[model samples]
Target: MERTERFCRIEMLIRSRGCVSFADLMTELGVSRATLKRDLDHLRTRMDAAIVYDRDRNGYRFAVTGRQARRPGPPEASGVWFSEREIHALLTMHQLLDGLGVGSSMGRHLQPVLERLQGMLGTSDSEARELVRRLRVVPPARKPVRGRSFERLAGAVLERRRLRLTIEADDGSGERDRIISPLRMIHDGGIWLLDAWCHESEALCRIPVPQVRAVQTLELRAREVPMRVIEAELDAMPALRAA
Candidate 1:
């Protein structure tokens, strides 16, 4: 696992198990003794974690007191903890959003959040800027979009609204209109897809964004399906005939 994932996993293991032995941590993380020691040291020193070696139990555990400094609001609200690679991934996603042409207003809104992320990696503004400048994300060429439905579809998905769509049949059949509840939008294999609950067929369907000829957002709220149900359906038939 990557160091970021390992760090999160370590925190979870410690919290859930109360005290995790070195051998157990090593087995769970699948790292050598030296590497695990280094990770623990980094967590305690760099991350300001309240990890303490428990001699009584011969394991590591979070300190009972004085582990975390008193801060305003809840812990989730106050902290933005992330590793260097995760920050780079976020920056890359930011670039992807910019490339999607919705970045004008959104970028302005997200700029401060990105800056905060950068702050976690550096001590000063200049250092953060310098660190961010070192990484560049180059997105691959995507399939040419056929119509203006991309923006409307994205908005509908975010707003949890129903949609009236005119999609070109993949089998060379003419356009078909359908009412669907937008569940999620996915970008896969350089093409965008809308996964939704089709009202006509009463099933989940995938619609290629490029195949979308027309889109109309409805005022009615979209149907909500549990993620587990979606995953189960997806697993049963990896490929569902598109709408």
Candidate 2:
């Protein structure tokens, strides 16, 4: 694999596991000891990653959190570099998600990863958070979207596949599952809604991201909806035209 890809995997692995052994990283990345050490050293010294080797654990961990410091814009990029701007963007994103009361998947899983990345941008997590809070978004409704649900929806839309959604029904019916052919995602203020072809309803409907409890991927062989059909159905929705 390319060096950048390897670096990402390393970050992801370490983030998910809290630590990873040298042998485990080597086996997973399929790289020599020298290449691994070089990448780790570059991340620590150049990118200012807090990856530290714990002799007791015999692995690496980011080892820090909290935000406090002015974040400069990214410097010129060459390779394997994450800019301060990117970090700030994520900081802002997490802030928004928090206001929206997005669900546990993003709150529990993704936030720490972003927090760690923010900490890597040469600031405490709190400082990175301060940078995000500097710009405020008006308060948003609490919809409880799963952490990874938004990302999975985007992937489903890009791949033109069906998404199985566990969402709240609008009619006081509480939650139910709907298989949908997702076409578009609309961001209204701090809210995210999906426009899709609902198999159960046999029509287009708005699926709120925050209301989504889970998103499941389908097999490749599952029947896929044509984008043209989705567009046509979307065009026919009176609410869409009214907007």
Candidate of highest TM-score:
1
Backbone N/Cα/C clashes per model: 0, 11
lDDT of 2 by residue, 152-172 (tens): 887788887887888766555
> Could you tell me every candidate's TM-score relative to the true structure?
0.49, 0.49
lDDT, residue 183, candidate 1:
85
Any residue pairs clashing in model 1, and if so which? none
Cα RMSD, each candidate: 10.5, 12.9
lDDT of all predictions, in order shown?
Answer: 0.75, 0.68
lDDT for 198 (candidate 1): 94
Range of the 10 consecutive residues with the lowest summed lDDT in candidate 2? 68-77
Whole-model alpha-carbon lDDT for candidate 2 = 0.68
lDDT of 1 by residue, 1-243 (tens): 777667778888887787899999999999999999988887776566678899999998877543243543222212345787778888777767755544453655688788666544534567766665665545467666654566678789889999999888888679999999988887666677788899999998888787888888888999998879876775366564575
